[model samples]
Target: MRPRADAVLSEWFGPSDGRLLAVPMSLRGKVVGVLLALEGGPGLNVAMVQQLTYTVGLMLETLASRPNVPTPALTPPEVISGEPEVAVEAPPAVPEEAPRAVEEVSVAAVEAPPAVGDGSETVQLKMPIAPAPPAAVGRAPEDERKHEEARRFARLLVSEIRLYNEQAVQTGKLTRNIYSHLKEDIDRSREMYEQRVSAEVRADSNYFHDEMVRILADGDADALGV
Candidate 1:
């Protein structure tokens, strides 16, 4: 019988003084690769170990999905006997020659720009400009306001639903009536937000399409594409 893989890895790294961690690279219950990390300093915590293991597992899964370099498999002696063999030959040698001399040029002897307007007119020189760094995408005031509004709306809806549900329960209705009503209202609010966001996205997409068409009609395709 074959020994367990985890037991094998445990034995391999157990004797070493340095800290060792191994994460199995698996996808859909199939092992694809393995990630090994060794630390010489202080030991790692449980949370850090778990996080590193999960990250390495994800990386391995991603790598396994991509194209990789192909390697040839080894053949047995009986299979190799049927293949043809080629002899290796070394290339002929060549003699070395002396290097040629090169002439040096001086910057002071180079021609300068001609004088403008008999040295009376002054011309301004432009300096080289560097590119600006990209702006960060962060939560804006409008987004915060929207989030607050959404939360307020959700709380109000929850309270109203709960009140109606309590009244129904007091009148001798179902026992879990309050929970059911609250769940329904919460689900409804989530669905409503999803629909609103989808509609806004579609509107923005349509506006972009119209703007592109107008720009193309005005013969400014280069700026539009850029």
Candidate 2:
């Protein structure tokens, strides 16, 4: 069976050490995809594959039967075919010639500002600068460190949640229904992380959530490196 190129499982297993177990996830005799796991020992055999397949099948059947279940947007595999070979003759090469020399133009110096009453030029050099707020200016290093820790954890949380969602989709767990099971845990963790950071930064709890949403939109979960 061919897996989509953009699939996380495909990309992940594209490079491996050769010891792997792939169990086909099927429902109603229709093969959806495969659930890949690293081979552990003798326990990783046909029986294990069959059991996993049955479990995945049950999940798919139950979720598919649910009303208003959301469909996952997994990458679908495309068909690959061969193209006819066309032999083309090479074009004759042209002779190389010496390149022409380029002329350099000199730039004029910026003129001085108009002279003031004292006969001195009043050069008002405008710079792009903004004043730091009192809260930010007086923030302790420990507070900054805490805030950074919070941001990093927030990114990690988003990355892990996305990874979980993708895995659920692969195992036939539709998000609209299955995700509600994980929502409370994710929200509690998020609140705790936010509270810890807010204590240090002296800010409202909603600020961290806002920051996480911004990070999520920008796909800045690189901190997790997953």
Candidate 3:
């Protein structure tokens, strides 16, 4: 019946422009939570609410699965302007006759120079090998996993949009007036994609737009008209 909260609330608690709706959010086959929406003005239609909750679940689950990225340390305002007040502890006083332990270098541990067995004998020093690039070696697998998850999530979101609006998508492609036909839907979907996809993934490539053009527009990007 009347699920919007404002209408029911206004009758007893005075006039209110607010609206409320809640839809179940499911990830895979499990219902994890509910999408609680509150608006001071107009509310989305039932179809939009359902579609939104579905995508919200997918996005939350995917994001939760990604490894946490460390945030950069920020300098405080006092540090920038001037040195902030800091307390320094004085080191404990040592005995006047405290003997400092000095480590003796073992000469035997060092390799001896090559003996001059032959007149043509020459010595070659081994240069220290440079360390491998940390980013390339250490982060390669993590980066690959991140990109894979990003691409998969993008594909899922675009596929759902295409699946739900199949008839409209087809008609829009034929008429080449997709913007007019589904401007609101496409705009909202793109907004969701932008919001859900991390900056790292976006910097690499916009897979959402790629899939949207490929699936919804039949590989003809111009068909979507943006």
Question: Would you list the C-alpha lDDT of every candidate in the order shown?
Answer: 0.35, 0.40, 0.53
* 16-77: candidate 2 lDDT, tens digit per residue: 33344444443333444555555443443443443344334334433333346344444534
Candidate 1 regions exceeding 4 Å error are 1-15, 59-226
Instruction: Tally clashes: model 1.
Output: 0
For model 2, the superposed segments whose C-alpha errors exceed 4 Å read 1-135, 167-182, 198-207, 218-226
Candidate maximizing lDDT = 3
Model 3 lDDT, residue 84, Cα = 75
TM-score of 2: 0.29
TM per candidate: 0.21, 0.29, 0.38
**TM-score quality measure for candidate 1:** 0.21
TM-score of 3: 0.38
RMSD of each: 34.3, 30.2, 26.9
Q: Is candidate 2 or candidate 3 better by TM-score?
A: 3
Of the candidates shown, which would achieve the greatest TM-score relative to the real structure?
Answer: 3
lDDT order, best first, reads 3, 2, 1
Candidate 2: what lDDT?
A: 0.40
